[model samples]
Target: MRLSGKRASQLALNAFIVLLLAMSIYPMTILLFGFTKDSLTWQYNQWLPALPMWFTNLNYAWKQVGTAFWNTLFVAAAATLGGVFLSSLGGFVFSRMKFYAKEIIFYFIIALMMVPAILGLIPWYLLIKELGLLNSLWALVFTSVFGAPIFGIFLLRGFFSSIPEELFEAAKIDGCGNFKLYYKIAVPVSLSSLATLAIMQVMGVWNDLVGPSIVLTSPDKFVITLALRNFSMSMSGGGMLTNYPALFAAYVISSIPLVLLFFFASKYYIEGLTSSGMKL
Candidate 1:
């Protein structure tokens, strides 16, 4: 009787897990159905797939978001590379090197993370405007790179400091210099952490709507999020009528790159997150 009860409870738990997973993915599944069907089919039946995949929806969305897609890709990629490089370098400096007021400076950098980002929006905007970077992609790239390194530094610092001193001592014994030790030894071992930082930076830049909306006024300079917002507004006839299929298709298209990024880097990304003690 105990074994049977155990088996029943195990089955119940499995069912609950499946239920939760379905609930989680239900919205995306509906989005897929919406994007796959034509306007008439969607209007008639809001759920379930229909025959003849509507490629035109994607084509129209592509035409609308194509420029912004490339712009976002460039900005995300640039920010990822720049953030990883700077954060890793900063991590190495704090971890392996001894310098004057190092503890104080490191603590100061970490303290900045406690402050709310929204509080700096106005000042950041004025600074960008003063630099004549308004409506420029460079503005986004520069700010993403420079403004978001605190957490990365903290993460990488802990990882770098955990490295065995014997390795650095051996490298020094072999006449390896500081820069070589950094690029050759410290970085190679911390690729997972660096990958984590890159993934985070890219994701932040990719999904950000408000920052781009604030900095970029030109349609051509707009990122994917901004372009999608405009496209959705236009397709909806100023909120009177809406094209569900095309708008959903645009959302799906906007999501593909991030999905691909994770699909490829998921191994490294997972490792980085686990090692850094981060949840989700």
Candidate 2:
């Protein structure tokens, strides 16, 4: 059978994509296999998972990583909820309401996004200290809730503005107030966008190391990233690799929250990304 040039090109592109996907997941596959091996087997084999599947490593890793995991989950949840609410409210106001100098105000808010976060690090730390948020998870929550909303607002304003004006007018005619319109119409209509923002915020707070490292001085308050780093370093014991299976298990365990998040929210995440900003 002879293939047409277009068909041949399509097959080649599909094969290339599959190859790239495999390459991307290969390290993760190895990590999964590595976690199932015992220390002695890991030292000898160093590749495939061995027999007797040491589930003890997972138990040990869980004991070490569980507290930090819950702490991180709490932070991510609070930050995402607060940030998304504020961002959506701001977007609705800017898109639907009449206010003085709204454009200028929005542009000013958006302009802050241009200022690099690193430049504000010292000032932020000082403010957190002054507020007595040092050594507290609330510091991270406050920063994330306030600092991360600019981009969310920007993304959501377009979605809100694209909504048809007739819906608002009809709602208003039925005695719907601004807040009611926002809650009933705007929010329901933009679930995918809201989910997208929530996922981004959750992922950001979940993976953040620097903010938690600086604000949280106590081990009890540590997030997963910092905890994982400390765990790995402690396992190394001055750079001599000591418990590969346990460390790999910790890595795998730390990733479960994110995996579950994407698994559940993937439909909305994909829809939000692909959906156009403008509506007729």
Candidate 3:
């Protein structure tokens, strides 16, 4: 069938979008090629070449990569879990409860969010040092945990507020206590928001380098970001080829979990954002 002019224009627009997506992904695809290419010169060459791909050297990358991957995973998982629990609980309380100083306390918390992270970094480091948490994963985890969940709480509180008060009143009539109302009613109702928050927390903590760089000095405790920095340094020092392909391969590996999680939870994530009056 012959296309109308408008339909043809739409088809052209769609083709442009497809081309843009491919362009964005091309560098990453090329990096995968670089990872397997044995010769440094070949890997550095701008044009693609005809060569048989090899997986044998993956073991070499895997050796250090595996340990770093696990360390990062552990930190991200622990931080996300802890952050979700605390932020969700705080959100629930702020949404539901009324206390004499609650508003003041929350205002203070929100104020802290406005403070630049650099301004607090020195104090935070000093506190961590006093607690003897340096050179430990807990140092990073604890620091992240204390970082005010103003945004998380604010997002979740809006979501919780949007929930009908009638549901909680009905639950109370059924002899449900505060804990039961929260666990049975609020939690189930706000799962979408919670899932969104969890995804954000995971992505933030997983990709974080600054906190770990400051707190974790031990090689064994290094997260993927720290490990990547070390790898880059080693390459710079002539210990290894500064293979862009290998660096990109490591980045791709690190990014996969967060990407997959976001894809699967995309609907809920979008819903949560929209419901919470957030743009993205």
TM per candidate comes to 0.94, 0.93, 0.87
- Candidate 2 stretches with Cα past 4 Å from truth are 1-8, 237-241, 275-280
Please report, as a residue range, the 10-residue window in candidate 2 with the lowest summed lDDT: 271-280
- Candidate 1 per-residue C-alpha lDDT over 175-204 given as tens digits, one digit per residue, 9 for 90 to 100: 999999999899999888888888899899
- In candidate 2, which residue pairs get closer than 3 Å at backbone N, Cα or C atoms, i.e. clash? none
Number of clashes recorded per candidate: 0, 0, 0
Highest-scoring model, lDDT: 1
Q: Rank the candidates by lDDT, best first.
A: 1, 2, 3
Residue 278, model 3: lDDT of 48
Candidate 1, residue 208: CA error in Å? Answer: 0.9
Candidate 1 TM-score versus the reference: 0.94
Candidate that beats the other on TM-score, 2 or 3, i.e. the better one: 2
Q: What is candidate 3's lDDT per residue for 1-280, written digit by digit as tens?
A: 3568889999999999999999998876776656656655554563564366555445666655667788878877787788887887888889998879988888877777667888878887888889998888888776666552767787777778888999999999999988788789888988898888888877777878887888888788888888878876765655344555555556667667777898899899888777677454
Off by over 4 Å in 3: 1-3, 40-51, 237-245
What does candidate 2's lDDT look like per residue over 57-128, in tens digits?
A: 999998888989999999998999999999999899998999999999999888888899899888888999
> Which stretch of 10 consecutive residues in model 3 shows the poorest summed lDDT?
41-50
TM-score of 2: 0.93
Which of the predicted structures, 1 or 3, would earn the higher TM-score when compared with the native? Answer: 1
